[model samples]
Target: MDEELKKMLVKILENQEEFKAEIRKHTEAITSLDEKIMQRTEALFDGYKINSEKIDELTDKIDDLRFDVNNLGIKTLKSENKILELDRRLAK
Candidate 1:
């Protein structure tokens, strides 16, 4: 009976060691995944920043183009008026 008890006690100790090992493995895996997630999140933020800057630059360029187009339209109107005035004078 004593030998049987000893065997059971030894088995329990072995199982405990296995359990600890498994826990360590899980902890390491969780830590690795956390690090990878942080890296990906940082990369996303960096990409967002770069894209935001590009958008601002494009917006400024579009504003400048719009201003130039408005000026061109005014010039076209002035030219048309002058052509009409010349026609009136020739008719007279």
Candidate 2:
């Protein structure tokens, strides 16, 4: 009976060791997965930042174009007035 008990205890100890090893493997896998997720998240944020900067640059360019168009309109109106004045003087 004592021998049987001893054999059972040995079996339990072997099972415990296997369980510990499996736990270690799972922990390592989780750690590796977490690292990969962090790397991907950082990369995604970088892409977002770059896209945001480009959008801002495009918006500034659009504003500049609007300003230039407004200036052109003003110049065109002035030229029209000058041409009308010239026509009136010629009529005299």
Candidate 3:
């Protein structure tokens, strides 16, 4: 082969090797970013689940408190009725 042509071929081969190396770096970076995104997504889901559980617990407590309040109201009404009955009997 002619010397000039040989040098050109050598340069082309070198350029190709450099391009391949650059592509490999980009692929590796993309893979790393994908992994990080997945991890972040998982963490967010876990946080959401914890928050949901807390909300459920709070709801249950509120329900229990409401039930107690209703019972207390019923008891108060009964006491008032008894007081009125006793007062009427004494007056008679």
* RMSD (Å) of each candidate, 1 decimal: 1.9, 1.8, 2.3
- Can you give the TM-score per candidate against the true fold? 0.80, 0.82, 0.80
Report every candidate's CA lDDT: 1.00, 1.00, 0.99
TM-score of 2: 0.82
> In model 2, how large is the Cα lDDT of residue 16?
100
Q: For candidate 2, lDDT tens digit of each residue in 19-87?
A: 999999999999999999999999999999999999999999999999999999999999999999999
Model 1 CA lDDT for position 56 = 100
What is the Å distance of residue 3 in model 3 from its true position?
A: 7.1
Pairs of residues at least 3 apart in sequence or in different chains that clash in candidate 1? none
In candidate 1, position 88 carries an lDDT of 98
